[model samples]
Target: MTTSPTTTTLDAVLAGLMRRYSERVPDVQKVLDVMLDAGVIQSPDEIENDHIAFRTMGVPNLGLGSFEKIFLHLGYERRDEYNFVEKKLSAYWYSPPRPDLPRIFASELRVNELSADAQRIIHRYTDTVTSDPVDSLDLDDANAVDQFLHQPLWKTPTLADYQTLLNESEYAAWVIYNRYYLNHFTISVHNLKPGYNTIDEFVAFLQARGLRLNSAGGIIKVSPDGDLRQASTVAQMIDAEFADGAIFRIAGSYVEFAERRVLSPFQDLPADQITRQHRREGFETSNADKIFESTFTTQTGK
Candidate 1:
């Protein structure tokens, strides 16, 4: 199967877009203003209720369950969340691999000034260019077992290492359960209370306490149109049984289950065959509920 084209060429193009758009679209501060105008999400609600967090998948190192804990803390029922890195990100939300979860977990983003055309570009790129599995473990419940094996976290990352990953792996994660877009990076605004207009408001709130968040430094990207933005981060493949940093990138929490490290192969699959394999392996495309429910037993709660 085809490995992801070197991350440099693809990621560089996306990074340039991030820098250009950050200026056009407001950051956290501007997001607050827009939220007030649209009557969508509110300031207090963002901090207290709709608190959000995220993660990203690095190629070959599919960190699928990366942000399940974060989403759980926000009161998204753990059982309701899901992940996928096997197909297109949009496809997962549009048609989930798992049929159990509700759309409420799908954070409907409001691309404020984001042109419809720009949005299409973003989606099309991922659909056509990024729709392939880097590698996966061929074991039962592959994603689940791998997540347990590698608990990745470079928490004490030196500034040098932090900036390094940004250039190569622009990773992000979503909790949607659609097989087509499992482990895709999603920004679900629905987690917040109504009345907030834009997503920036919440972004600002997240930046307040100085928590480790997606930023311009590394593993993040902005779109070319100066309207939409995307960020990526790596999942530390940690396991007491495994060596420190013996990690592989993940798609959401799904680890590519294999006896050893390898890239996911579902990428080179024929379009029709991909679907057939999905069905043959009883490939679950959605798991929105399980992720949401994982939050309850998490330590992120106040």
Candidate 2:
């Protein structure tokens, strides 16, 4: 099959995100290493990436409106919207142009819904972005898009501002410091070899390997219908430099594992005949709510 220009560009953009994400989040390589040692896969590429996520601050000329444009231009279709009321977050999942590509789960903080002082702390940094940065990008240029995704959208935030936001919304503090960096890339566990193919088995493998699992709701988050099961590693901490070069160790990024069980109608199909379409689709709000805390001090402080 011939890959279109849009798909090629999308490939490069995803590659850039994963490369840097793996470098910053040690758990990425750690997970891959354990999988390799356990014969779960022959190489890292053999793993199916279910999806990748990004965090953003909801403010003028930014947030989902601006961020979604990049992927939408690459042929990704916007799926469902999810609201995290308590966290003051709104997110949407985007289906990939090709099944081989990972889906996108992007969320933005509801800056306006935050406390007056918290909003002030966020706007102080985000206000610098007077225009939607994506509007300036030539989406066809893979290199430019890759660079834009990694470049700073605003000035480096001060430790004080970050701390204040953290007290209000950890999501806000994350966006202020992390910007558009990939929050996480999930591994599709359903397709793995037998013993490692289910979320329970996979979580057990990871726990045995000494990897810390996020226990916000439980080590494994199951949807109400029980078709989608998910789990994540507690976000690894990074020594981050704040404005004026004050260094502090804070939550970075984490790896997630998902198992999309075959829908009831497709349960009788032969294993080999089952594809992504035969399984449960989309994300669960309740499962995602706790998954968001993978980076919170509540989890990272553990």
Candidate 3:
């Protein structure tokens, strides 16, 4: 089968994301190493990426409105929308053009709903973006998009501003510094060999290997229908530099493990005959809510 230009570009874009994300999040390698050592997989390429997530600040010329365009232009179709009332967040999951590509979960903080002080601090940085930075990019040029994704959209935030945001919304503090950096890339456990193929089993493996697991609502977050279950590592702490040259340890990215069970209707189908569509799809708001805290101090501070 011939690969379309769009598919090729999407491959490069996803590859670039995973590359930098792995470097930033040590848990990614920690998980892979344990899996390899246990003979769960011989190579990293064998693991199926369920999806990757991004966090943004909902402000003019940025946030989901601006960030989603990169993947949308690459052929991703926007799916369901989720609202996190308590956290003041709105999100949408996009289905990839090709089944081989991991789905995208992009979320943004409802800046307007935040406290006045938090909004002022967020706008101070985001307001500099007079227009959507993504609008200026040639989405077809994989390299350009890769660089844009990693580039800073606003000025370096001061420690004072970061702390203010952190006190109000950890998510805001994260995006202010991380920008478009991939939040977490999920490993699909259902496809792995037995004993390491379920969220429970996979999470156990992670725990036994001495990797920290986010215990927000629970170690495993399951959907209402009990088909989509997920777990993630607490965000890694990195020594971040502030605008005034102040250094502080802040949360970075992490890795997530997911198990999308085969839908009831397709459970009887032969294992070899099953495909992506046969499994439960999309994300669950409840599960994602707790997953979001994977970066919160509640989880990281533990």
Determine the backbone clash count of candidate 2.
0
Off by over 4 Å in 3: none
lDDT score at residue 272, model 1, on the 0-100 scale? 43
The TM-score measured for candidate 1 stands at 0.24
TM-score of 3: 0.99
TM-scores of the candidates are 0.24, 0.99, 0.99
- What candidate 1 gets wrong by more than 4 Å, as runs, is 1-185, 217-222, 231-240, 243-302
- What tens digits encode model 2's per-residue C-alpha lDDT throughout 1-302? 89899989999999998998988899999999999998999999899999999998889999999999999999999999999999989999999988888999999888889899988877888888888889989999999999999999999999988888888888888889999999999999998999999999999999998999999999999999999999999999999899988998889999999999999998899999999999999999999999999999999998
lDDT of 3 by residue, 36-55 (tens): 99999999999989999999
Residue runs of model 2 more than 4 Å from their true location after superposition: none
